[model samples]
Target: MSALAEKADSPLKKKPPSWSDIWLKNTKPLKHVVFTMPLQSLSPKDPKSQTLIPTFANIDRTLLLSDELLLQILPKLPHLQRNPNSLVCKRWLNLQGRLIRSLKILDWDFLESGRLFTRFPNLTHVDLLNGCLLSPRDSGILLTHRLVSMQMGSGFCSNRKFLEEDLLPVEVVDKGLQALANGCPNLRRLVVINASELGLLTVAEECLTLQELELHKCNDNVLRGIAACENLQIVKLVANVDGLYSSSVTDIGLTILAQGCKRLVRLELSGCEGSFDGIKAIGQCCLMLEELTICDHKMDDGWLAGLSYCENLKTLKLLSCKRIDRSPGRDEYLGFCPALERLHLQKCQLRSKKSVRALFRVCEAVREIVIQDCWGLDNDMFRFASVCRRVKLLSLEGCSLLTTEGLEAVILSWQDLENLIVVSCKNINESGISPALATLFSILKELRWRPDVKSLLASSLVGTGMGKKGGRFFKRT
Candidate 1:
């Protein structure tokens, strides 16, 4: 044993005390004394003691985050709720001003109060569907210099209480819209549905910066008001008035619009009740028209024949146009649309095979065709697809006379075809589908048909032989 160990253990010879004894002897004040007598080490046997130790007051306060950092961390937080920054702390309140540049509150009563709008001054685009009681003055207040686009719902004009009590007659609605237009000088697009004629005129006059205007369920006076927009590029007119009768936008109104909007490229006219004269006027005035859609109106082959004059026309959609009879001269009219790329004919009663052949012959550049619920289409029409070299997508749904043989002929001829949809055609079966599938399996991306479960499973498991992977084949239920 060393000298230190021997002194710690010795009981005589003035042995130096151990470290623990020295500490006790050196201490001056002692509150209590404890004796360490040998005993069994006892501890509780509870299972929780072996589990995780419980802790209190473990909150960490050193990580203080700033609002700017929080906003940078989460930019899409405002889209989750209406005025989300308002609910956050005052530090986040300023974020609402920066984020709410485009506000679209549709039919939510909570947003009806103008308080939300007043809170954010940077709003540039707003769409109010319903729930707000906006007076003419209130509407003007909402239109600021920053606002560039605004869409007010039909409810604004249709409210019974506003019409009877609050509204300032038709003249007042016009003045309000005009005021809004004048306020937002940068306004580019405006859509007001179910408003009065005077209100429409107010919009045309005040919103001079408008490039596109859509007015539905209006009157002839409103159509006349559209003449004020000299720079308008696109116009949509939907008339629905009771007891107020007017000529179906005769040449007089159309001539005025065409002459005014020289830069017009696209025009959509539905439920106009106009004759071929209006269409002729469009053809004569708007020679630069690229896309035109005329639905639920009366138009004969003469009107279509006039459309051939529109050299720039690329897309033409005629829905429920029953006046276009399938006559021998129909092909001559179809020859006019040379630049046509897409043609949509729905429930038009197109029966003649020559008409179909003429359509394909005239519109040689057609890449897509949709013929739904058209009557009198037979094998001859199906055979016409063989000549359509550019056809990529074809939809023939509800064409009862179309059979698998016709589809097979069309599919086999289409080398560049990508998509083919035949819905509710009872005559089409797997035999006709399989041949085309084998030929264009590589290029084909989508095939929709109603086939048996076994055939569908087999087609899915065993691909068609086109030197490429097979595409998806959906079985209609």
Candidate 2:
């Protein structure tokens, strides 16, 4: 029991029992536990806490979602599912209606019954062409004072008889228009067939935001109603399509339209007959007019001269026209459109050399010229386009009579030309290309030369290694 004996005994003494060992010795033994009652109940309730639990069948996830979250999700669904989604609930129906911006109404009652507004309050575009028809699905004869006497004995269908009673009363049509105008104050575009002036006047007065309007079977008087559309920029007036209907728009209607819609930017006249006076009014008054499309027109002999008055006109399209002008008058008197940039002619009959030359003279300042499917456009007729010295883009298609030499002569004169597209021209072939024309093609910024199917197939097979000789079927020439 000396000091050395005490030190040795201290080293032998064990350290205090560790905490983990002490806890394991003091903890209770583990036992398996099982739930006695069912995890779910049909009539689950906590009476003591005064709370009611919901069942899976009674719970609705969509109802729990906020309107803001639903709005974000509903639009991502495909359009085909919209109709079914709308039928899910009243809230969904209202939300789906808010997304519709355009409607083509075939039923007049849908617009007149004040339902369209309640259902879709944000509509911006509407088309009422079919609604106004007497028998939309059937062909009905128009009842008027002048009637064509058909031979009953001839080869006419006996069952196909159209009577005047099939047409709707004028008053009934006006009521629908009034309802539409009152309900859709934000309408921006409208299309109607055989609409009266009174009906259109109501629409123009209410829908001041209207920017585009199309009127089929339009007459001189209908334009009077259209004049009220102050914001109107684009208009397509179809007087007649074929011999089926006899409606006319003359100088008087043109003058009214021009004076009222001074902000007009684009105008299309289909089967309309006008003189110099009408064209002059439009060119002078509609200072903002940029595009003009004339289709199957019946203008006077010297109506071409009036285009010069359109100082801001940029694009001119001639479609399915029988002639440019019977007589465009002297070249000195026919001034050019100062700001004209593009001239497009499609499916036109340019048979007369005199009229074609006059048209080329007027559009001499054009930068782009596109001629497609034009008949009687030979080398002599195509030469007239050489006057467009500033042309930068030229697209010629379906010009059967235009030979490679004719195109070369015209394009060589265009020193500023950068883009050229020639397709479906039978007379233009790779064999006709000269050294000078080949050099021009090389210097061009972009060139698409597929005058026939053989060239197009060869070009497509060029890089794919589909053809012989290293897939270089189309030579440089």
Candidate 3:
């Protein structure tokens, strides 16, 4: 075939795809893709070929790093590391949330419901402020709180006080529980105030590892919910929601709790009444019960009989406990807790020698003693404290009946006393501060009776006001 004729007959070849087309297919924004030459070079007739197109000179530095690398680096960098593109990528933002092992979310308005677990995955402990948790494991967060109390009788009508404490910033409804159940799979410890039965049940069902729980004014449903927590070791039942009526927790709920939570080791009941049955149930079932703290409630003097059953009980703390039996020679009926080791009484009524002896009758293994605001207790009560050879630490605060001579008598007899704290003891005046007491103070590891100790002994008369203020520190070594 002739060359000219053959060329005319041949089909035209297709142009290979250009860099713009290839790069544009893979890149996020086509505007970011640039070429060395202007488009006019390909089409000679274009009028604007002489003009130059300026490209963006700088690229975002973060965009250069791979998503995996960014995830590892983001947590190490401070929160405000780079403000420009903090959460440019969707996946990276989600990953950043998982790095948070501990968090306190004061604002529910900001949190998206049902995403709590995805937001914080490694959190082992959670505290709800009218809030709830999603799943995280292995990592734990610590929360320290004061033993905030109200003046002894100030809260008798202190319904207003309860409003501030037990009420949630926002009520936890069904949707909230549904979100929590789906999200918090590894929750180990939780403290939620005023949570309803459904919410409580959902947590027990979903958070299988839950060991510690604190709730206000529990009922049957709440107990049913907690019954499901097979690993529960610590429980604090708050009964002082002044505005709210005491529920079935006092007796029925307590019985169920004792029957259900057999693994319990520490239990605290505040502002609770009608205690013998409940206390007996706990002692009978929770053999592992080690520490029991009861405050601002009446358990009848007979409640001590039930507590005698807790063979493994180690520590007993009674604050403002009522029903003192000053009847003489009832020491036999005073009850005995052989395993008892540490005793702490604050603002309790120890009006008679029998009352004081009855309370201490069970403190056989007593090593540490803290007596505060027990005005009725005089030199006679100190005699009971003197007998415990295992006693190492002693703290006396607001004991108006205690004089310098009584302290001397007791301190001299205590064979193993290591630390002593006397604050606000009215009767122990300047004349009472003998050279011997000063010499004794010098030998101890912790001696807290300062020279200016101005008799806080009247704290009870001034009233145990509500809130965290107006209390002396009791350091446990």
Candidate 4:
């Protein structure tokens, strides 16, 4: 053996550390720099010209990414976590506050103060749907300046607004309206549940751009307030109340609305005790009115006579109503209005055959007929469709009195009939499901029970004041 081989084989020989061992020890920077070779390759030669390595901060981060990038990200995070992210740094907090434009707090109880307005100064929309029934002190805290669309829902007791005020020491008053007027001048759309007439009137004065409004349990004074909104194109008045007799919006209120709201194109009255005179006045006064929906409202044919004068009228929807037109002589004047296009009857009762015939005769020009949950209508009433040949769509739901045989005979004859929807019609299912009816339903398009699809779609569009034409109606799933 050579002298070099004898030295390698010696037990006392000092061995050099492996590359992995030296690299793993972070503290041994000098050894790593010398051994890894690559670490020192890019090391600055001039100590004076050297720069520190990049980091989350201290580097030219503003050059690499702008504040605008951060502003876009912070607000997009979930609301619960947004606060945590903002707490990370002052820059993050500033971006979060500046970037938020709209806020929708489902719980009103959690909405503590005007701090929300300060936090998001540029907010255009605010929806406080729940917790409208807050105490007087808490209710007073709801003040916004920049809201364009607002929907505040609350519940109240008492049939009359005045009674409600008397029962509850605190009510939506001029004070609240003053806040909205002072802050939300750009307000265009509002849906407030259980607000007083005076408060609504105050809104009309402040929100000149107001185009659409929905008020639950409105009264004559409320209608007067609505009249003040000269730009109003759509209005829905709901008179139903929880544990209350009814809202005090009768023919008197309707008359007020008809006289003042000339720009109205669509109007809906629910649970209103309005008669023919009030509705007739609407047709006579509101020249721009197009669509009308009356739900659970008191009426007879007097309104039908008046509807003949609505030159631009297109659609009429009767829901959960009874005796839509009983004044036989006057409604005869409503025959064959070419512009009237669609008729929808839902959960209604046509007490007399004469009344049924009268209603259908006026809608002879209607292209679509939607019938649902209507009683006192028999196979004989289905024959009305024969005369109304223009009806391309016939939708029937829960019409227990209507038989399939009677419907098949009338609908099949109409060449323009494009669609027929039959759902939960008890009498129709008694006999074997007619092959002809089955084939008709199978071939026809768009058939189903639409519970709230129309309203939901409309809310997403009209409630937000986002679309001009608003939502198209669809069957509910």
Instruction: Indicate which candidate wins on lDDT.
Output: 2
Per-candidate local distance difference test? 0.58, 0.81, 0.66, 0.65
- Which wins on TM-score, candidate 1 or candidate 4? 4
In model 3, state the lDDT of residue 327.
43
Candidate 1 stretches with Cα past 4 Å from truth are 1-78, 88-169, 194-198, 240-247, 320-330, 346-362, 372-387, 398-400, 413-418, 432-463, 466-477
Give every collision pair in model 4.
145-183, 301-326, 450-476
> In terms of TM-score, which candidate is stronger, 2 or 4?
2
TM-score of each: 0.61, 0.79, 0.67, 0.66
Worst 10 residues of 1 by lDDT: 143-152
Candidate 1 lDDT by residue in tens digits, 1-477: 698889876787576669989777756543232222222223335645532333223432322666566556556654666365566555556665655555554332333334444455444444432222234432433312111222223444332333123222454445445554544455566655445656656666766677777655445555667777777787776542222212254445566677667677888776555544666667777777888877665334444455666677888877665544344255545555667788787877666665566556655677888888877666776687677788888888787777777777776777677777776666665545564455454456765544322343244325543221233354211
- At residue 412, candidate 2 shows an lDDT of 96
Could you tell me which residue pairs clash in candidate 3?
121-136, 135-183, 135-184, 151-464, 424-456
What clash count does candidate 4 reach?
Answer: 3
Backbone atom clashes (below 3 Å) for every candidate? 0, 0, 5, 3
lDDT of 3 by residue, 378-452 (tens): 887787776676788888888888887788887876767788777777687546655565555545666555323
Please report how far candidate 4 places residue 86 from its true position, in Å.
7.4
